[model samples]
Target: MMREILSFCALTALLLTGCTMAPPYSRPEAPIPQDWPSGPAYKDAFSKPDAALAVEVQWRKFFNDHRLQTVIAMALKNNRDLRVAALNVEKARALYRVQRAELFPTLETGISAKKERVKISGTQGMVNLEEYSINLGISSWEIDFFGRIRSLKKRALEEYLASEQGRRSAEILLISEVANAYLTLAADRENLKLARSTLETQQAAYNLIRRRFEVGFAPELDLRQVQTRVDTARVDVARYTELTAQDENALHLLAGSPIPADLLPRELSLVKPLPDVSPGTSSEVLLRRPDILQAEHVLKAANANIGAARAAFFPRISLTSAIGTASGDLSGLFETGSFVWSYAPRIVLPIFDARTRPALEATQVARKIALAQYERSIQIAFRETADALASRGTLGDRMAAQQSLVDATARTYQLSNARYEKGIDIYLNVLDAQRSLYAAQQGLIAIRLAKLVNQVRLYEVLGGGGDASTSPEGL
Candidate 1:
């Protein structure tokens, strides 16, 4: 009988293994257009057929600078937030394994001894009784005829995938953040250097005017005007110095370790430019972004949950069985002809459960919510990529125009100072020219920094990172 029961259970499980009560799942249509938006903002955008996809480009190749690559590596290894994300992925994986294991019966083995007192029916006296047995069998294992357990397993698998994608997103964001902080520090340092240089020039002019006043060749007013320029430059130098220090602190936090002095950026001009990336002609690239993929996985998990909820309305079948050897004496427990077995199959059909309908409705609503969230993620990615492309369109022109202004102002300053020496103009003219040149130089530095930071933003939004191979689903 025990052998027959085991054969029946195996056959039943095999027959129901492929059955599922859940609705068929299909990916919803993307709510956005196939091609990227085009307007004045995206005028300069272009794509190359031979260029690698933004998602496939390695961070090391994109960054170019050896020092920055080193810092990013450090952050990936030690950043606390990223570490927590990785841990979460592991936790989700374990949970999925636990759920999947439910599809199979758990086999258990044990030895037992029993002692009890039983009252005699006729003698009105109590007698001791003892028995021993050894058993190996399954207990209360659900038979998934309705696919309820399988649906729950599927949901767990999708959730695990979603968690993995989330970890990748966190890693990409951290890399971009580190690069931005490093660039900021370099820009501030350059600004500080420019201010100090301007202050020295103004101080020298002030000294010259003071000497002329003492000799009765220049007035006190001319000396005071040059002194004002010196003081203004002094103020800027102090401000930029403070900013550079703060930038370093921010970089340190991202790196999660002290940066080597030699590895730190000294000036924006010295930092190498990031490699160019194509947005491709299609906006579908956004689907490959880690965050978007994570959202889609969440949607899949929700869909699977709906199937589990549907399965709940059907009959639930469970099997409990044991086969072993038993005897009144412990020494004879495993002897031949002492074999014993039991099989108890149970079924639970929901007759009047008030929560079943509401539970199914809740799962359907949850799936709709996940669908909306997935579409929203795609929209947000499109906007971010569009904004970055827009900045790219005009930054080159801005840089060129800024450089021209700096050159023009420098010429004006030199000419004004020469005219004042020859008594062709008032000393006030030279003071004004000096101020214009200093301001123009500052503007050029700012434009350069913007151009570089924009490149980083574009790469980040396009999901540029080198860690994982592209998913076969193309997301």
Candidate 2:
């Protein structure tokens, strides 16, 4: 019956203590819009609002290039930013460990011996005396009460978790960047090839015109017109070649290796294709994005910090105790009588702190600021996901139109050349047709590049790419 009464008292203390402190935290009432902005919603833009996504079907799985996969894998392990992010995780964890240790008692042990000689005439006689003293014991230790120590430990652990999330966010970005860069290089190579092919066509036309002039069938003016077209096309090809080289170099730098001359294929002219991107609704993707997760962790840490700050306003209760033995001789240091120990539970009432109120207020304000930042992160993620979905739709339509235009221009240019050769149209008509085709070709490139680039942007918007080292999971 007595033991049952004791258990009831213990349960009562736990319940009462829990009630005295702030309750478990709930997130703020911030806006989480359920739907995306209207206009150009893809055929299957999203199935549901922002919900957490599975990690397996990441952006890397979107691309089929083996070369790209290899590069991304290597970057994760070697990228400098990823390495630094890893270090940050370690630092936060260590800080949490230190703070956690503070909640428990600290015990230290030491032994000391002292000798003193006293000589004085005031002692009634000249006396030389020697004394040896030794002691060993704990001096001070702290006991936590009033929730201060517990709150501090809790805050530290939350902060550690936040740092871990932050590292994952960095990893996500790194992989995304590498994917975009490689794809850009691929598209640029295709543009360069197109430029070369166009130049070759102009050169053939010029050769035919020059031969007609030699046979006295074409005038100098007609030959010069053909020459002008050839020159312009040649210049364009040269510029694109240089641009492609620069892109290659930049890609190598990001990849952290010497890009093989064949690092990428000579041409990447894919038959028009776009991925079937299912832009999951706002609610579905926003929370899964690494940055948003990191921000939430930060919010938790901030809430814990407020609890710690509030605990500081109350009296601190601590217990300090020590048990040790000391003796005048080295052999007796550990003996039973050569020991001294102390224990105390101190209550330090905060009667005043010229600096405490201001500090406490500052902490409270800082926590509020952190909360705002966390909410903003959520809002930003929501908008990005929506924007990407909308772009994919518009870009797809634009790409289809551009492909038709290129096909039509190519056929028209060929017809004009045939008519000029048969004397049905003037040479100037052929020149005009060729110029139109060249511009149409370039326009097609711009549209195609846009499609690929926007897809990359969409990936980033969803926090989908980058090497694992820089990704949230890798962190």
Candidate 3:
């Protein structure tokens, strides 16, 4: 009969505490326009209709280069920031479990014995008093009649989910960083190679001009001009050498380990092109972004906190119960007639505590703050995707113009050099053509790198070329 009564009470507690005081949650409308902004800058901003969304593509497939894929994998495994984010997810999960466990009673068991000396009423000597008992019980466990504990459990669960989204956001950011670093290093190496090739060409020209001057076939000014070009090329070669070394160091840092020589890119020209990505016509995709989702989860957690705070206003109920057996003699501790049971119920009414009202107000304010943050996250995401689209629209024209300029300059340099060799033109014309050609070539490389990197930026700002649902290695 006692066991039946205890089970009934436990079931009633569970049923009563199931409901929450939290307001219904409806996702806020996206603050951005329905469609991606269209203008001259967004002319070619989108991919084919059939192309997959950036978030649907996996990192391994988006980054097709074998070497780049290997580097990103290594970084994902070793990056400290990503590892910390994963650890935080684990920590939040543990905290949620702790909070959830409070919804049920905690049972404990114990055995105790006591002996003391006492004086008898009419005796001169003292007598020994002995007590022995064994028991099983619960201690001050909350029954949660007003749903305060349940609301807190909900808050903890939302926080755990938020932490998980944060980890996904970290993983996406790290992959893009590693890829960008790799691309930057490749571009710098290409620049170094160009400088070295130019140096070799100028050095050979200087030797030829020197021989001509010795034979009185070329003027002293011609020899000096050729020598100046050679010196300038030498300077560029040294500068780019330094730049390439620094680029490698940055790549190594992003990779979180020393990059193998075989995995390093020799030049941008040799690297494969990155695949194109599509941002669907709707701005709704931003809602699925990990950072945005993380913000929403945080807002939901804040909402849950408000529920907990509101539940504090009415009353708080807790149950402390014990069902056990006890006896004065050790042998009788578990005897038939020694069984006992007790239940103490407590209710705390917040009649005039100064803290309750303030706490509730604080939670309301926090929810507002979280709402603002959630809206701001959407705004920022929209801006990033817009900026990447703007660059994408104009980069193709820029690349074409730069390539044409390089071709024109190369032709001018070839014609001027031939004329100088035939004694029909002065050395200054060749000098000017040589400088123009070098500048145009360097500009072409810059434009090429910009175009490629813009593609990467587009991939990143559209929430990355990876799925958030799947966990990465180490996470």
Candidate 4:
């Protein structure tokens, strides 16, 4: 009879699993475009199926600066924010392990020994007895045929992958920041050099005027004007020197070490040009960017949760069974005659749920929200890619023009100094030319750094987070 009852209960659990609304999850269909939106043609010739798409490029390698690479390496190793991101990957992995463990049965074992002395009422005498028992149990949660637990485990794994991708994204950003900061410091050093050189040149002219005044070939007014030019140049040089120091300090912080100036890059010389972004192929960033990968995992988790929510509407099945012996005397425990066993299957059906419908609605809405976030993430990636590509084109043109201006200003400054020395122009004219040259020089430095920074931004915008195969630290 007991066997028949247990068999019927198993059959009943299977029928309940079938009756529940456990829908199979599917990704919504999206319109896959054949080409990029802008005028980016693929190679202008037959290409071997996106040879560049084979692997995500290492941004550090692209910079090709050993100093920059070292700084980024240190930052990746020791930066606090990046460490926090790495820790999150471990948390996600633990969550995944917990979910995975749910797919298997659980076992519990128990043992107890007690001693009691009591007075017997109504029949007259005091009695003392010792009792002992031991139990072993094996139980399981019914997955039935609904695959609810399976979906949950799948969601957890996706989330774990997502966390790992997030860590990669952090790494990319940290490396980019270190490279950019190093570049910026190098530019500042150049500006300082230019300022000092200009100051010394003006001082030489001032000395020439002072000598002429002492020999009566120049007036006191001429000497004063030349002295003013020299003093002003010295002031500007000092200002830039201070700024250069600040930039160096910032570079040190970014690199996670205080590198000596001699050890650091001190002049802008490398030709790491900004990337020529093409925005190549629609939604490619979605597959490439790490943050996007993480977002999609979140969406997958939400979808899996929908099945989990729907499963709540049906009966829940859990089994518990035990084999044990109980005896009035401690010596009788586990004896030949002491044997007992019990098994139970629990089924809880929601017969009159007062608030369950709303709960299901909430999960449904949550799924929609996750889907919306995922879609929005894709749209944002596209927009960022477009913006980076457009800026790359625009900045390239602007920097070319700015470079010309820098060259022109230097030529003008040189001519103005020569004319002043030959008495064809005033000292004020030479000073004004120097100022123009300085401004143009600084502006060019800014633009150059912008171009370099944008190259890194383009890579980040492309969503190139690595896959699950990349191991998380302390995992």
Candidate 5:
């Protein structure tokens, strides 16, 4: 009958402990436009929004260069920053588990032995006592009568989720950075090649003019002008060489290890542009961006904290109970008559503490701060997507114009060279034409690189090339 009564009381206590003081959660509305920007700047880029394009495009599919793909993979595997972000996620998960464990009793078992002697005066009597016991016990486990433990557990879970989203954000940023660095290195190499070829051409021209002057066929002025052009081209060669080396160093740093020479692009002239990405109209896609999602998680955690603070106004209840056996003789510890048990229930009421009210106020303020941060994240995402789209709209037109300029300049240079050979024009005209052609060619390369880089930026701001449901590594 006694055992049955004890079981009934335990069940009642469990049933009464499930209420929570937390307020209902609703996601804050985004503070940006529902649709992407419209007008001349965005018309060509977002002409028809493919709502599913961003979700479907993966980084590998977007970047077709085998070399570039390999470098990105290496960075993902070896970058120190990304490794730290992944570790942070694991740390937050373990902390959540620790907070969650408070909801359940922790059972512990131990053996104890003691010996004591007492001496009395007068008639003289001395007694020695030995005691031995073994027990299993629960120590000071919170019963959570007012939902304090439950609220804290919910807060911890939200924080863990926030850390996971943070890791995803770091991964996305790293992928974008690696792609940008790779593209920069390729552009620098192409520039270096152009500069070296121009220097050789100028040197050949200078030698021809010097021979003409020596043989009385060309004047000293013509030889001097050609020599100046040669000197300028030499300077360009040196500058470009330095830039290429520096670019390689930057790329190596991003990769976090030395990249094999064969894995780098000898030239990016044949590389294809990244595919276009569509930003959906509902601004719902922004929700999938890891940074925005992380902000929301932090806001949710703050909300849970408010609940915990509110619960502090009520009494906190905890339970400490044990059921085991005790005996004077170690061999008899497990005997039926040696059974022993204890149940302790404690409650703490906050009567006059000065800190409780202020603590609650602090949580309230933190929740407001979180809400503001969440809204700001949405605003920044909208602006970045708009900027990328604007750049995409006009880059194609700019590249076309630059190609025409290069063609026209090349024809002018060829005509001027023929005139100089036939003695119809001075060598100064030939020098001017050559310089114009070289500048146009270099400009064309810059425009092409810009077009390609903008595509990558578009992919990044549109929440990366992969689905938000999975990470770059599919972790």
Candidate 6:
């Protein structure tokens, strides 16, 4: 009979698993254009659309710099923010396990002993009594007939998935930040070198002018003019030196440790540009981005919560059962005649509750909010990718133009110096030409850095070359 009772309970539980109050879930339509933007700005950028997913590209393959690869690898292992994100995933997994366990009964076993003394008012004596029992039982375990427990479990599972995606988002952001910081450091180093070289050349010119003035051959105005140029170059050298130091500090912070000197880029020329990537034709690709995936998982969790809230309005059933032995004496506790058992079933019907209706309404509203958030994530991703593509298209042309300007200015500065020495032009002409050459050279460096940084931004906004199924370790 006990075996039959257990089998019946198992069957009932199995049937209950099929009954869920949660509404069916369907992904909302993406609120962006079906195709990527096309115009003069995107003409060159959209030339090639690859079918390959971005997330599959390894960081090592994306960044050719060996030192940069080493820094990113170290950051992945030691960065505190990434570590916290990974821990959150583990925590969410544990919470989901706790919720999932509620679907099944929890069995407990124990032994108990008791002693009591009783006295009768009329009687001259008191009596002592003792009782003992042993039993195995399930406490008030909810039967989940309305799927409340199941819905809660579903919510927990979605939260866990969301946390996993959150971790991936952190990793992608970290990768981009590290790459940008490294590039900035390299650019600053190059600028400092240029500034120091310019200062040395200007100082040489200033020294010659001062000697010519002292010997009464050059005017005082020419001496002062050359001196001013030297001072300006010196200021630039100092400013760039400070910028390079700060860039190193920023890179170390992102790396989560002090960076080795050898790992730092020696000059801008040595830091290779990342290879070009094809941003796919459709904005649907943004749906696979980690942040977007995280938002969708959160929305699903909210949807599951609505099911749990709705289930609260229905009747709840719980069961408690025990099988044990009892007797007046401890020795007879397990005797055949001492065998005992019990079953208690409870039903909680909510005929009226001020909180239940409000709670359900709140969950519905929350689901709506989550849906908005999911859509917003999609919109933001679209804008970012579009902006990156636009910048990428124009940056190449701009860099090329700046390079040509540098070449023209350098030639002008050379001719002006020769003309001034031959007395064909005044000192002011040499000064103006030198200034233009310096400005043009600096502008070229700035444009080169922008072109490199834009590539990193494009890769980041396109979702870092991998999908949700890819492991975080792959970053």
Model 1: per-residue Cα lDDT at residue 192: 98
Candidate 2 whole-model C-alpha lDDT, 0 to 1: 0.68
Model 6 Cα lDDT, one tens digit per residue, 310-391: 9999999888988898777788898788888888989999999999999999999999999999999999999999999999
Give the runs in model 6 whose Cα sits over 4 Å from its true position.
Answer: 50-52, 119-124, 465-467, 470-475
lDDT tens readout by residue for model 2, 40-59 = 47543553335333243565
Q: Residue by residue across 273-358, what tens digits does model 1's lDDT show?
A: 87778888789888889999899989988988988899999999998888899988888986789998877889999998999999
| Candidate 4 Cα lDDT to native | 0.71
Kindly indicate the candidate among 1 and 4 with the higher lDDT: 1
Model 4, span 119-221: residue lDDT tens: 8778577788777888887676664445667667767877898788788878777776777778877887787887788788778878888898999987788
* Model 5 alpha-carbon drift over 4 Å, by segment: 1-19, 47-52, 119-124, 465-475
1-475: candidate 3 lDDT, tens digit per residue: 7697889777876665578888889999988899999999988776466778888888888899999999999989988888899999999888988898888778988788988999989899999888877768888886776678878988888888888888988888888888888888888888888888888988998999899899998889988988998999899889988888888888888788999999999888888898888899798988988889889989999998988999888877777778777777788887789888887888877788889899999999999999999999999999999998898888888888988999999999999989988989998999899899889988988887888888787777778754555332232
TM-score of candidate 6 against the unseen true structure = 0.95
RMSD of each: 2.4, 4.9, 2.5, 4.6, 2.9, 2.6
**Which residue window of length 10 is worst by lDDT in model 1?**
466-475
Q: What is the RMSD, in Å, between candidate 2 and the native fold over all Cα?
A: 4.9
Model 1 gets an lDDT of: 0.87
Estimate every model's Cα lDDT from 0 to 1: 0.87, 0.68, 0.86, 0.71, 0.83, 0.87
Better of 4 and 6 by lDDT: 6
| TM-score of each prediction | 0.95, 0.85, 0.95, 0.83, 0.93, 0.95
Q: In candidate 3, which residue pairs clash?
A: none
- Model 1 residue 471 distance off true place after TM-score fit, in angstroms: 7.3
The candidate 6 region of ten consecutive residues with least summed lDDT is 466-475
Instruction: Give the backbone clash total of model 4.
Output: 5
